[model samples]
Target chain A: MAPTEASERPSLERLLATREIMVACGPGGVGKTTTAAAAGVMAAVKHGGKVLVLTVDPARRLATALGLTGIGNKEHRVPDEAFAEAGLKSRGELWVAMLDTKQSWDDLIARHAPDEATRDEILANPLYQNISGRFIQSHDYIAMERLYEIHSEGRYDLIVVDTPPTRNALDFLDAPERMADFFSSRLLRWLIMPYRSRLVNVATKPFYQIADRILGTEFLGDISEFFILFQTMYDGFVERSRAVGRLLADRRTTFLVVSTLESVPLREAEFFAQELTSRHLHLGAMVMNKVLPEYLRGSEAADAAHTMAEQAGELGGLLSERMGPAHEPLRDSAQVTRVLKEISASFLNFQTVALREAEERDELSVAPEVMVSVPFFDTEIHDLGGLYRLGEQIWE
Target chain B: MNDLLDKKLLFVTGKGGVGKTSVATSLAFLAASRGQRVLLCEVDGKGDVAGLLESPPTAFKEREVSPGLFAMTMDTEEAMKEYLRLNLRVPFAGRIGPVAKAFDFLASAAPGVREILVVGKLCYEVREAHYDLVVVDATASGHIVGLLAAPQAVNSLVKVGLIRNQTDWMLEMLTDPAQTGLVAVCTPEEMPVTETIELAGRVRNETTVNLASVVVNRVLPELFGTQEEEVFETLTRPDVAAELELLVGSDTAPVLEAARLAVTLRRTRSVHLDRLREAIDPSVPLLYLPYLFTRSHGLRTTRQTATSLGEELGY
Candidate 1:
């Protein structure tokens, strides 16, 4: 189970071995977070290095399994004892950090602010408070900023980061560039200009009048004051964001697009993969999770199901008579027939879905370096053992 | 509480990939088929509503995709333009280009401005009585709270002006239980259920809108009852399965295994369903929609879902 061993098939293990950052991103509700954690766990156990998983949100039990409970904005090492508890031994350290968006934003402001007074004032600003707390795109921007900050520290050999669920998967990829542009835009200058100079030119007068009438003078003043306070940190913020953007485009950084075989999410993931290629970022792997079992697609099984459905009465009578002595429940021919019909119908129903999934797989337009399919587990993956089992399927 | 469709405005939201758009489209379809004039607006502008309806793509201008059913995709910039044209009466159409560009920048920087535009447009439809009902395919659970609370957020920030004045009526419409309601859709799974519960709490505490109902989508069918399940177990035993294979002239193991998988999946999901039932307020109706075992998703699937929804609503 050595992740470092070379195999004929390209595996996530081999991909993680070469990359410094592996970003797990896709449409939401596709087990992106769990896949990211499993990759981090496997890399630590098999590749023998300090592996860190920076995740936004994980299921309660999975978080507990990784010992990430109630800890935010701080990285915690997954103690060796937990691996022992899960009946495993890790060859290297594994760390986990949950992204705290508000805290991350405050930290970014603290880092970029020109002075302590400016930092305090910005932090206390109601507008700043609202943006840090409820701004949707702020989540996208801060996740990348935190990853950049963590990677620059050189603390781990590998960082597997799970992206926040975005309206569009491409949002985070463009967040840093957007942030940089926002700081240096001419409109931003115009926004804060009138307040600083107390003079409105003819060209800007209409803009001012409309803004004043629409948003009110008081609200406009609050916005002006917030931006003016933000102006002092503009250069630092712009430089930091650009560096974050560059880090994403670095050779060692790669993206893993996780998705299910469902049509809507598959379409979104395909668009994401294409976008990554278009942006010149490395698309390392595409892990399709919760795939229906291959056995469900076998012609032999389908034939059996069809036969059972067609001759349930005769089959039930025959089998019940043969097994009536050992199983009393089989003696009831009508009930046994019902059971046979139900199971067969259920099987045929699932076969249709499995076939649909196969068609969706075939229609996937983009191919990454590696494509992996993980079968749907009957039970939820809520523990370290479950994660390990899931990881092994994609490990090759 | 059962008057879900009777409300003038209904915002359907859920975690992504949980069939939120499908549920919203189905609700609109269901309403329209019941002889109600319905306007369906997609707030995210993903054009999923159009795909679900098998109609041409929707845009800022609402189009009649079906008889008595109109669909549109929300564009905050277009909404702002419409607002300027209608409310401000400022005939600056030639000059709106720069103003819109500037406003787009402001919408990005200012927290609730864009959200307010979307909510304001929907509320305006309700106010003008443009349709018997308006169904909005709103943002996912993660952002819906912010979107629903935008008017209040704007009110707290803006002390005076036209935008401030506009918030009063929108808030009035949104806060009224009879006029507005929110439907939270989710599947009986771990993440979607967890998020639905969390969203329920946030919507109750933070927003003025009413939680009209919770739609549990993709619910698996129970394959067997107690006695039948016992018989199924006995049939799955190795000796019985081997005999059955001989009789059927094919390997029955995979067929049986698929059934077992289905049963386990249903059992696991039922636990989460129970948790969701316990977590949500008892007064809010829980609507269950079966998992459609169809070959493709299109108008056919939408019709099936709408039929199921119609039955759930006691039609």
Candidate 2:
């Protein structure tokens, strides 16, 4: 490797070329999923290897373009024809998969259960059904668990995982540990002991009595039954979760914190980056998406906008007189004035936001090694071509 | 159509960073300014509601942040304690520390336990007639259906628990259009719009709550009409642009380019806005809030949002 390459500032391209895993996460509505897909695309295009993007949910068009629609928990390759259609060629293969939480949970249960009967019983359990399908927090654990499963398979050279939109952004990071602790906790044993032995001790009688009344004895019994069945797979679950934790903290894994320049998402992203650093996880790059253009921040633009807004009528008159004979539309001074005023006012308005974005960028406390900004695209990024366009902006 | 503020409870939710807190705070402000006693609850406990209101951080205990306006942050453990005291008549003073911890663990394991507590507390405020209106800054779009459907989930699972009995009335209040409604907030962007549309469908089919309205925040101003747009195009032509630069005594390209960017942005957003309108039920009103170009967010932004919300509500 060249010395210049070694000393160069870290970029997403370099990060992707080096790391085996990139976890894209931050606040919702900040293009985390799309950015992850773009990064995966860039990796496949620039580096010759198999790259897979594991996204929780994608827009319908993007899903269709990636052939991800109705294909849950299965990785699919993006066809060469699709790349041709997008006017691009990839050096390596690009793959996509959507996280199917319930399917992942069922697979986990099947893998860990002591016997087929126990696996079927747990799958049939109503509480298990609800926990697997309806529980929101279950998503946090299952996503990471699925990633661990896929990574262990060694099918893809690079895996870009888009995390679920969690209530707290850090939930998935703590999920493996929490899952391990949940099965090992003494409370689980205490809560299920009576059901297991059919005896409530004198010291524990009051607690069970209160619980029985509040939860109803039958519900308590059901809960105990569920936990009792779950307890059978405790060892496997704990060991698997610990392995998942190690995988996240591994040197080959890196995190890409994605956010917009807006204050709220930026704050959340900053906090997420700080937490990743404190946890000794690699914060490889920060991708700021949908950022306003730099031209909006130039003093020359502000000066021009100020003058235009203040002297709109005079400028409109001067321009209309000079150009009205050639262009019929400019003949109307009033319309021209309105246009100039609207243009200047719009510029100033966006300038205010642009300047605020600069401040927010400056105020970001946690600095990752590489920070890249994706300029706002006028149209939605819904296909490979659009993704390629976005990928190119941050590739360097 | 029913007036929005006339409803006893309103849950405002959206994808994060789309100004969910602002809409919730503004709705509370609008209701309070109209002399209604409004209790605003933040379910995520982010303290964003308090920050938007320019009030001190709120706890599970409601505090009057303004005249007729009360604010609180949801703590599921505190709610469980209150439920135990009020319904079960459990002695919560002595053993609650440990008992609540144990219940917290159970809640974490149980699918709907934590969600039920949140919905239960909000319903309790309504059932007690403590406030004329209760506005919840609820969970994001992804988790909201689970939260709102918790009662039905608990009801089907628990059969005969105290929670089962509690969910009946809560479901009654939630399903009733006169008493409760959900406002889905979104920006005029691709993901937010898609999520909002998907959320509306889920809230209708999965949960008992009514989709009362969809608030589209950050609708960028349309910079030109057809005739004026032609004029703008003329102004941007190199020859005309150069003359305008000389007339303005500065480079006018950036200013014109900014306008072009703004126009394209608004045009692109209008497509999503149209899709949102077409996807959502026609009966549900779509309220548009203009993008704020303010330097900072605080009470001022909240008040401006409230004013816009008022105008949209035809106040």
Candidate 3:
């Protein structure tokens, strides 16, 4: 695997890739939200047509970078003048949304089951009421379906999303299956067994006996009653999970493994890439965010290192008589060039490994590419106006 | 190799900043060294586990860096997406335009990825019968708990089919101490110590997985009595003007250099240790480590960290 920087690769922008659902995956704090936004914007502005830069629990950073605050699924008209200012035409459009899991779950119930009886039955299902439904349960499957609804509305060409950063950012990748399996499981149903009737009781009695023998079935029995009252819509959940799973696996989806130069984030990205490939998902690029580029030998870092060492030397001498000799090492490798060089190799090594791994994964469809962003400065951005400026760097 | 080969799941975790990534790599290396098929899994997005193993940062794709050490950073959400597609046999599974992105947003509506699902996936990996050790670099405490106990996290939210049952089974499997060993790493620092102890407590409270020893990274050698006084004396020397070359040889300069930085490190670390004393179990003796002479903390530094941790854990 040959390690290469993002700059080393050609900027291949295929905005229509949005026609395929792209999963921008990476570890936390690795500009995934921003890159997804940037990709969405690039797809819309450069490639043409309406693009929906839909974000789910996006970092305020992504919103700030996109020059839009309080942007959700509501199609905000980015005043023609603004797009013009960015040299983008008004011909394309974007719709933004934060995936409200509970809301999405509600929406799915409302849309699929028909009438309050069904919706309530489904929603109140103890099984559906399980922890997986609200967030872990039916949230992801419903949201993934919502993407289709938004797309079907013909409102946008691209829908960019910022996923939650937890568990290697692939929880979204696997949530639907888990949620569906949850709804499909008999555990919660068994919970309600004691409450429902003879059949339910009969089914749950065994578990109760087991519980009684081990941890006491009375408590578990009560929980089972609650479960029965809660998970009445077990069948509905299974149906919905199947529907959404079908939509996600559709050919139009693409998963972009996002990462930074750091080891943890990069490994997480690769894990995402591998998972996506195994599932037969289209992996477009490895968006390496906030990567530190190797600078020239006598550059700012060198100067900064020297100055810091000098100051530290003075501080050490002031602190102790024994510390006077310690300043030598501080001053010796002050430039940080050698260390930087090694880190650079380490960083590039990550890229090489990623690319090679991508190349090997037959299902990924594309080699692991790179998308590097600058390390964020601690400065604040006022609004979407600021996001536009930040977007300039992310796209390139 | 055969010893590790029988192990289906490898849950590698440590106190924050204890070089769990490095230890994960070494274990993978040890497993791989014997030609045992292995995988180094990084659950936290910080996926540098491969760096120490000298492999590219791989995602779900298990990229083989050496003979048998295949590595990957597991993305739980992405895994969730794939799970949906694969298990459910989602038809349009290929073109998930914005689908996963949306899934991600929704997943966040909760605390995080469901622990059971994540752990379930781990179980899946472990049961796959493909790789030997599915080494997982779990999240820092809260995140790990969320990932491992996701089933518990969303115990009330139910859908249908195998996914829900998967969580139950996973929760059950994870609680079986014989099946899983939970290794935790921590530095002697106060925050990490507190977190590690809390983490240990949670592992005990939440699941029955075995709590492996904690690995304290970048541990400093304790300089005692006269040697400490001599170091202090050298640094605080009043008469020496031109930075008295107290260092005579190659090692001397670094020793002196170490002596100089030692004060600040010791002061800060001393406070950290004091705070930690009350938190960590007294029986869990922290493994001491010397600051290595290096331009950067790289493979070598982390490799040593893993070796020390391994020694501590009697790996």
lDDT, candidate 2, A1-396, per-residue tens? 656663266888889999999999999989998999999999998896999999997777778766445546888888888888888899999998889999999999999999999999999999999999978779999999999999999999999999999989999999999999999998788777855353546655666777877778888878888999999999999999999999999999999999999988888999999999999999999999989999999998899999999999998999999999998999999999999999999999999999999999988899898999999988888788889899999888
In Å, residue A204's CA in model 3 sits off its true spot by: 6.5
After superposing candidate 1, which stretches have Cα over 4 Å from the reference? A1-9, A196-199
Q: Kindly list the per-residue Cα lDDT of model 1 for residues B236-276, writing each as its tens digit.
A: 88888998999999999999999999999999999999999
Q: Write the per-residue lDDT of candidate 3 for residues B220-281, one digit (tens) a residue.
A: 54443444444334333444222433221111222223333444455666665666556656
Report the C-alpha displacement of residue A396, candidate 3, in angstroms.
7.0
lDDT (10s digit) by residue, model 3, range A114-145:
46776776566453454433333244455566
Candidates 1 and 3 compared by lDDT, better number: 1
**Local lDDT at A8 for model 3:** 51
CAPRI quality level assigned to candidate 3 from its DockQ score: incorrect
- Candidate 2 lDDT for residue A209: 71
The global C-alpha lDDT for each of the candidates, from Candidate 1 onward, is 0.91, 0.91, 0.53
Lowest lDDT sum, 10 consecutive residues, model 3 chain A, at: A332-341
- True-structure lDDT of candidate 1: 0.91
On a 0 to 1 TM-score scale, where does candidate 1 land against the true structure?
A: 0.98
- lDDT (tens digit, per residue) of candidate 2 on B1-315: 438999999999998889998999999999999999999999998788877888999999999999999999999889888877787676548766677778888899987899999999999999999999999999998889999999998888777867778888899999999999999999998889989999998998999999999999999988888999999999888889999999988888999899889989898889999999999999999999999998988999999999999999988
